[model samples]
Target chain A: MKVKVPKTLLTEHVALLERVIPTRSSNPLFTYLGLALTPDALVLFGTNGEVDLEVRLELPTEGEGRFLVPAQPFFQLVKSLPGDQVELGFGAELSLSSGSFSTRLSLAPDEGYPELFFPSLEGPAEPYPLQTLLPVEELLKALSHVRYAASNEEYRAIFRGVQLEFSEGGLRSVASDGYRLALYRLAKPQPFAKKVVVPARSVDEMVRVLKGMGEGEVALALGPGVLGLATSGSQGAAATGKGQLRMAVRLMEGEFPDYERVIPKEFPLKAAFDVEAFREALRRVSVLSDRQNHRVDLLFEERRVLLSAEGDYGKGQEEVPVRLEGLPLAVAYNARYLLEALSPLSGQAVLLLSGPTSPSLVRPGEAAEGYQAVVVPLRV
Target chain B: MKVKVPKTLLTEHVALLERVIPTRSSNPLFTYLGLALTPDALVLFGTNGEVDLEVRLELPTEGEGRFLVPAQPFFQLVKSLPGDQVELGFGAELSLSSGSFSTRLSLAPDEGYPELFFPSLEGPAEPYPLQTLLPVEELLKALSHVRYAASNEEYRAIFRGVQLEFSEGGLRSVASDGYRLALYRLAKPQPFAKKVVVPARSVDEMVRVLKGMGEGEVALALGPGVLGLATSGSQGAAATGKGQLRMAVRLMEGEFPDYERVIPKEFPLKAAFDVEAFREALRRVSVLSDRQNHRVDLLFEERRVLLSAEGDYGKGQEEVPVRLEGLPLAVAYNARYLLEALSPLSGQAVLLLSGPTSPSLVRPGEAAEGYQAVVVPLRV
Candidate 1:
């Protein structure tokens, strides 16, 4: 197989493939990337067993063939190649040449390369039971806000993922790590109700792929065991035209916790504080918080809220002015959780509390965005 | 003790101390920084057993006292504090107040804090046998060129240091890991000859200190077992004023190898190539070089050089145009070593070759810079 392609476009696509390719795997074949040339395009494939990614480049070719090469070294060679175009030829070995630079990469045996499922919009044998199209911006915004709260603990399968819930209202994303929960409502209603828990690791890769797709609506197909995302349009006006990217993730099989019941419906007390000032105070006070629990106390008052923390190292206190309503109250929270929950919000933030030990709700200045978070107070 | 200092000045000084203070140490006392308040200045002390650093900031104070605090936590608090002016007070605990933020840090047992010697210029009790002041730029340039060649192996006492040679000719810094050698001559003659080997780790800290010192001359004092570096004045006009920093590093004990003997004095062949082009070509070809030796072969012809490398992955080749002198030659060298040695040079780089298996010379386009490197060839 022989093909000549623009170096910049090739480098960009290879980098995307590199992100999904595992550096090492128990199945050694998984560490290799499949390079296949068809009559119309060159395709690159990468996977970590659970998630697979394919990037297609449309280029005029001499012959058609498929081969596998070590992902990392091939990436390095592609990035380091000089000039505007690179010619790839497969004969005795996979030969790559661009300007004065050329390399013969030893091909990994292709017999063991696993067949990957390619998701397409039009296909009679499509395995997906449900398919939906949503604005990339809205989906990305929701993922960014909720992804941070997902649990990283391996034993807690359901909590280690971001739950995508579809109902008559809209598509909502929820993530919780027991102590804290974050939920984002995208407001894109679906025809049928559905729920899927995507592993946090794969969610991160999906974010990367969606970002690279660039300013276009994404088509998401949901199956019993697999979730597929595909983008067919070019990146931009001057981008490599007609190239396509597709990604698939084996879904996590488990029931996500009933998070709706835990989200507080009523708050007897409400306090609005400048987000930047409150965040700064929390960071300073948390420096002295106990290492084990990272607990910081917040005492709500008439015109200000006092924050304090005491640990083996020392004790710290700071006061931030807040517009308050209802009776003054006090709460103790894991400072790290509160900090992370506050990180994705800006302008003014409202703290809605029910009692001392109950989960408190945090909302952005404008609740119309449908972004909310809940933090369970630590027992003193 | 009580004092009010500008937050920016305190932060800058604390950052310098943070560099020398070990995050964790077998001697627990070494993990704390000594905060001493004098009538004239506030002095901060940090040490890592082998190296010590002190930063002095002159500020008006209400009282004078010296205490010790956990270095890392205190640094974090100082960095996170708000406002421009910070008020520090010591009573039951160390109290720090900046704007609306305040913290009381529990002091580490000050009785156990080690006593560190502060080097000065006016004292007759000076223990240094030799003292010299050189332009910071010259010293920094020399250090950058030679530091990379120093061996990191802990057992190699002498090779794990950059040897400083002060003689009638000039102050020359040299380092070698046995396979390669790098030397930079400062051309500033000394009054009395002296030689010292500063450990590579200490050299790194010295670099940081020198860079922070900005535009000025650095004073170097050589004791029997310690090397002292001190810089006075401020960083710049719009910087912390009247602050001073001093650093002491315990010198490595051992006799350095005679590196001059390996530097080739005569060459039967010479090849001059564009530094940027040659470097790019080398980077591309080295992607397929053997993992262990990283060997890349150079075949010098009449007007160009061919570079090739083969390993388990595959083989790569590239051609770079060069002005050749004397007989055509072929030689191989570790790509990593050659790359590092060439990193400090630009414009046209001349390769002086003596033979296939002997140490070759690498010099910048204009050799007047007094920088030279010797890389031993790998046997093919």
Candidate 2:
């Protein structure tokens, strides 16, 4: 079998597959990427047992063939080739030729390659509404805001995924690690009403693909055990295009914990301060905090907030003015957790507190409709 | 004791001292930075067992006092302070106060600090001319060109230092690790004729300080066992300035190996190629080379060079045009060594090969006056 494709398009397709391929595996066949050539198009598949990605490029071919090639070296070689027409020939071995460069690659046994099945979007036996169109930018923004809060602990498999809840009004993305929680709400409602928990690793791969896409719409489909996302040139012509990229990830098997109870509803003290100024103060004072606990004390007064940290080596303190209402309070928090939560906010931030042992809430000062972060305070 | 100094100047002095202080040491006193305050100026000192550094800042004080503070926390705290005047107070403990912040730091025992001695430039029994003035930019440029070639092997102590040879014609800096060598020559001659071996760590610290200096002159002083470098304002006002910064590094005790015999005097094959193009080809081909040997074969023919690498996983090949002369030859080299040697060259590069087994030399295409790099080829 033989095929001819533009060098630039081939390079782009290989780069997308490289992100999903596993670098090392006990089974030798798992380390190779599978390529199937048909009469109309060439399909590339890569999987790490949990998440699988398939990309299709429109190319005119002569015959049907299937082969597996080592992921690392082949990806690197194609990236270095010049932007011209590239010819590929396959038999017992694979040969790639471009310009004055030609090399032969030994192929892995095709018998050990796993069979891949993509979930169908439209079928008579389908139970759920599997097709929904979403704006690409809004989906990326919602993931970035809540991905960091997902837990990495393997014991509790439920917290290792981010929950996507769809309602009549909007879509809510929530993540929690028992110590902190982040909630992001997007106000673009769709006709489908369902809930799904996507694994953290799959969310990361989705973000990488979405960032490179042009201004368009992404089509999402959910089946029994898998979730698929596909993107093309534009919204109207998504089904028929020159080429398309699709990713299917296995959904988590457990139920996520209830996070609404974690957020404190009643607050006796509220303080509004500049986000930049508060972040800078925490950065300076935390330099002297204990390395293990990273505890920093915050003392709220009538119109000011004092931050201090004391360690075996020395002590540090800083003062920043704030607009305070209700009763004044004092609390201790891990400096690292606070820094991560405040880094994404802009302009001003409002902090709500109930008591020394209660969880604290952080939100944007002017708008509290879309996003919120809750952090558990440490004992002073 | 109490004194006032500008925050910017104090931070600069501490930054210089922090480079020489060891974070962990068996002797507890080695982890502290000593500050000795006199009527006219303040002196700061830090040392490991192998190297020592001292800096002076002119400030008015009432009496004399000596104290030692933890190096890490103190340096970090001072860097975070606002750019304003800071006050220092010393009693049983050290106190630092700035704006609305203040902290107390317990001091290490003064008796545990080591005694320091500085070599004099105007001594009566001096044998050689001790002082030579040079531009800061020239000194920094010379150090950056040849520092990467220094060896870090502990068994061969002589190979770990950079040899500084000063003569009537010029100053030469040379470093070698048995496999590769780098030579950098500065054409400004002085009246002093001396040979010294400075440790690699000291050379790195000197580069850091010289990069931070303004447009000024640095005065170098040599004595029995130490090398001193001092810099102030412009050359005209160097002698009568408010304060001056000085650094003294202990000279290495071992004799350096002779490096002149390693440079080849004759070559049978000469190839001139564009540096940028050659570097890009090597980078791409090396991705498929063996991880342990990193061997890449270069085949030199009529007017071109073919570079190729074969590994267990795959194979890569690239062809680059070059101007060749003399006998045709083929040689194999470690890709990492060739990349490092060619990265610093600006224009075209000339490769001079003596034979398949002998070392090859790389120099600028236009001139061979100031710099050269020598690399040994691997057996394929």
Candidate 3:
């Protein structure tokens, strides 16, 4: 089989697919990118088993066939080619030529390559039972704001993912590492009420693809065991005027913890302070905090909050002026957790607390608007 | 001792000294920055055994004393301070306070810290036996052009450093790693004739310091077994108006190999091509080069250079247009060596080759100028 495509189009798609393709795999078949070519279009497939992605580029071509090439070398070759157009000829080895540059990449056996989740281009359109359309920016923003709180320990299973909860009220993105929980809400009713836990890695890959999405709404599909995101047109259009990108992530099979139980319903004490100033003070005072616990003490007083930490190295203290109300309080918390919780917030951050050891609530604005984080305080 | 200084001044000096201070040292004494306070200036010292550095920041103060603070934590603390001026009050602990931020850093015993080579503020100056002054820009430029070729293997001893040669004609910097050699010449004659080999790591620190140097000549001093670099005033002056920086590197204790033996004196064939075009073509063709030797075959044709490489993965080839003279030739070289040799050159590069297996000379311009590289070709 043979085909021709614009260099930029091929390079861009390969770059995106490279992110999902594992560099080293015990099974050699998993290291190859499947090239499925039809008479009028070429679909490139890449997968690391759990997460599969395919991108289609439309161009007038002569032949049709399916082949696999080692993804890494092929990716590097395409990026380094110095011509405006790339010609691919498949055989025992895949031959690629561009201007005065040419190379043949060794092909891998693809008989055992896993079938991708994307719908077949030639098959009858089997519409997903549930589908919704939403702005790509909103989805990406929601994911970025909460994914960092997901537990990185693989053994934690459900806690190592971001949970998407869809209800009549809106769609919520939630993640927790047991010690802290982050939630981002998008007030748009979905076509179906459902919940799914997507692995943190998949959420990261989704963010990468979403950033490259076009201005149009992205179609989201929720199949039995997989969640799909598809986008096409303007943003990454080829000169031939045809391009589409699709990503499917295998949903984690477990129930996320009942995170709402940890969020305090009411707070009698409130301390509002500049987010940037508070972050800086936390960073400074935490320098002398215990390396293992990273504990920094917060003493709420009239018009100011004093942060202090003492360790074998020495002692450190800093004061951040704040608008305090209700009553004075003293609390000890992991500085790292508070830092991460505050990272997604901007402007004045209001910390809602009830006691020294309660689950404290943190909101970006004067009132909780769309985003909030609950951090469990450590006993001093 | 008690003193106060501008935050920026202390931060900048600490950053520079941090480069020479090792984070983990078996002898804890080498991990601290010595703080020596005089009536008019505070001198900061840092050393990694082989390289010692000191910076003097002048400020009006009363007490005179010396103390040591763990370099890493102190560096971090200063960088995170949120005030304009930093105050230090010494006792059992080094008290540091800046506006609303304050901390105490545990002081290490200063009696065991290595004595710095910088001149004492109250003692009579003992001038270096050999001294030369040169523009910091010229010295930095010369070092940058050749230091990458230095051998990194500690067993190679003298070859793991940049050799500085001072003669009646001028100053020259040369380095080699057995496979290739690079030489850069500065035409300004020196005040004395000498030869010294400065380790590649020390050269890097010198480059860092030179970039921050004021617009004036830098004094080069050579004492027994040491190479000294000193610069002061204008660029890094404290608000109180006095500042000075000095660095000393222990010289490698062996004679540098006679590298002139490898530079071929005559060339029966020449291939001159655009440096950037050749670099890109080299990068492209080398993608399929053998992982072990990175060998890329170069075929000098009538008016172009054809580069090709074959490995287990595949084969790659590209042609770079060049102006050729003499007989056409064929040669194979480690693509990495040629690439590094070309990195320091711009515009047209002239390749002077005698045959396929001999050392090939690469010059930046049509005629040999101030820089050249000798890359030994692999017999393929």
Interface RMSD of each: 1.2, 2.7, 1.3
The digit string of per-residue lDDT tens for model 3 on A1-380 reads: 88898898888888889998988988777788889788778889898887888888877667788888878888888897889999998888889999999998888777888877763323223544566777888888789889889998867889999999888888899999888999998899886799999989999999998887746678777878788887754332456444688888999987686878898988889999999999999999998999999999999999999999998789999999999888999999999999999998889998999678989988886564678899988996
Residue pairs with clashing backbones, model 1: none
The sequence of per-residue lDDT tens digits that candidate 3 reaches over residues B21-52 is 99989878898888988888788888999889
Grade the docking of candidate 2: acceptable
Please tell me the TM-score of chain B in candidate 3 relative to the true structure's chain B: 0.92
- Of 2 and 3, the candidate ahead on TM-score is 3
Model 3, stretches more than 4 Å misplaced?
A1-4, A89-93, A119-129, A214-216, A234-236, A239-243, A366-368, B1-3, B89-92, B119-128, B239-243, B366-368
lDDT of each: 0.86, 0.78, 0.85
Chain B TM-scores, listed for every candidate in order, come to 0.94, 0.86, 0.92
Each model's RMSD to truth, in Å? 2.2, 4.7, 3.2
Scored against the native two-chain complex, candidate 2 gets a DockQ of 0.48
Q: What tens digits encode model 1's per-residue C-alpha lDDT throughout A1-380?
A: 79888888888888888988988999889889899998878889988998999988877778888899888789888888888888999876898999988889999778877788856866313677677777887788778889999998877779998888888899999999887899999877876688898989889999888888778777788877888887765633125544688889988887686778899888999999999999999999998999999999999999999999999999999999999988999899999999888888999999999889988999998888878999999886
* Error of model 2, residue A237, in angstroms: 14
